[model samples]
Target: MIRFGVDRLVADPDLLGGAKRVGLVTNDAARMAADPARLARVALREAGVPITRLFGPEHGLNVQSADGVHVDDGIDTMTGLPIISLYGERYCPSPAVMRDLDVVLFDIPNVGARFYTYTWTLYHMMAACTAALVPIIVLDRPNPLGGDLSLAEGPVLDLAVRSFVGEDAIPIRHQLTNGELATLWQREQFAGVRLDVLSCDGWTRAMQWPDLQLPWVPTSPAMPSFESAQLYPGTCLFEATNLSVGRGTDIPFQQIGAPWLDVPAVLSDLARRVPKGVEFSEVTFVTGLAPYAGELCHGIKITVTSASALRPVALGLLLMAAVASTHRLRFQ
Candidate 1:
């Protein structure tokens, strides 16, 4: 069985060493086990862990907020804890917020892409904790995309374009668990911070989500499925352009379209230039929100034939290039 970090921690409370006031950074996606729909906060609380405060990342505590929308601090209805918004006015917790906490624990789910904001949130938390002289414990999770080093891809990051989306110079598909990322950042950037990573049991670099037999929880509003996440390392670049990457739709990131696209031509070009492991079919959509909301978009639906063979970054580039050749594509 694939045991997540949260599972291991709750199973062995001694690992936390009776910390009286603990602060947790988590979201709805951070579940403790396969049943009972218990979040990490609830699991810890039920296990007699004293959780003093809750920290929410980009999508607030519930993971329901829209993309790029700021999440505000509020009380968690179930835990009744003061929830601080890390993606709101500040990307990191203030010293005041960390004052009463013995240790800060991070247990957010990541989609294995470097540009995903959760990893950046982890970075900010590490930096803040270092300044406050508090130790940090990261309850690691699987990368969703298997952790094969050979699959690592990058344009790294050009610090000039660094935003919440892309914070460090890591590959686009970083293929490392969140705990490993915490360790990397500590060694390379925040060396002074004391960090402990509670790793997943029975998980290896070759194990994907399906291999773990875990339920698919939406990491963000747009990332709704395992297939979508598998394609996200590439499709996410569409956010920089005027294209609709199926946001506000049931199948976000699985389809790409814009009203101006010449569907037939785009599909033909994609067939000729795009890599194997994916099949495309022309589709028309009317997005209810994001990018081209209320407008008709004509594009292609991407279906992965083989997850291991898919090179999403390369496919994204080729798809963009193909669409640009047939239509007047614009980047916002």
Candidate 2:
């Protein structure tokens, strides 16, 4: 069993360097893999780390808000720490907020995809900390998609298309963990800020999520299963389209659907082009939430048959092409 950064911090509190005022950036989903019950803040505090404030990236601290929804700043009734909303009114903490903290610890996990916003929050925080001369520590975890650098796919961020999701020019499936990302930026960009990465022990570059032997926590409401995450780097692209990426369904991102979908035509088209390590099966369901909520929809369920053989970014493009060829698709 690999000891994650949080577990290490709990075992050895001295790693914090005796910072008087420490800020923790995390959410409910980022709990310790070993304990699961105690969150990083609670665990760190119990271990004698002076965590003074909290920062929430997208989806809010408790993950109460839906994806892409803006969350407001609030206080944690559990910890009584002032929770600053980085996904809303601001993308980074203000200079005043930075002044109140001696160091900031980012403990969020990435979904092995570049489009997720937590990594970008780190990007923003790195800039803020660099300017304020505050040290930032990233508690690293294994990239859920594994660390096989050869498996990385791209359409590396074109500066023109960079948003909160694609903040840098890395691949859509950039095979780097949060700490590694921070390290890269420190070397290439934010060198002035003191950065430390509490890495996952014994985790190798070739190891995927299943190898971690860690419980799969849903970092976002939509991401409920490992299969969903395997499909995320590809299926999430549907979010920008008229089709529902199972957002309102139990199997979010594991399937794709739109009320107008011609299931037979889609199936026929994909029959010849199914990518390796993934299989498509016809599915019809109602998404009780958005897009065509409550309406019966038709589409294909994506299954990751072999994680090692799948290229999600390429798979995403293939899916888009197949669906678009079958129907007149619209982008959102």
RMSD of each: 1.4, 1.4
Where does candidate 2 stray beyond 4 Å?
329-332
Q: Give one digit per residue, the lDDT tens place, for model 1 in 1-332.
A: 77778898888888997789999999999997545277888988988888899999998889999877898999999889999999999998999999888999999999999888999999999999999988899999889998998998868999998999888899999899999999999999999899999998889999888888877988888988999999999898888888899998889899999887788988887777857799988899998977789999987999999988988898889888888877754533
- Provide the lowest-lDDT 10-residue window in model 1: 323-332
Model 1 alpha-carbon miss at residue 84, Å: 0.6
Q: Write the per-residue lDDT of candidate 2 for residues 196-244, one digit (tens) a residue.
A: 9999988899999888777788888888877788889988888878888
Relative to the true structure, how large is the alpha-carbon lDDT of every model?
0.88, 0.87
Instruction: List clashing residue pairs in candidate 1.
Output: none
Candidate 2 TM-score, true structure as reference? 0.96
Lowest summed lDDT window (length 10), candidate 2: 323-332
Highest-scoring model, lDDT: 1
The alpha-carbon deviation from the true structure for residue 110 of candidate 2, after best TM-score superposition, in angstroms, is: 1.2
Model 2, backbone clash pairs (residues 3+ apart or across chains), number? 0
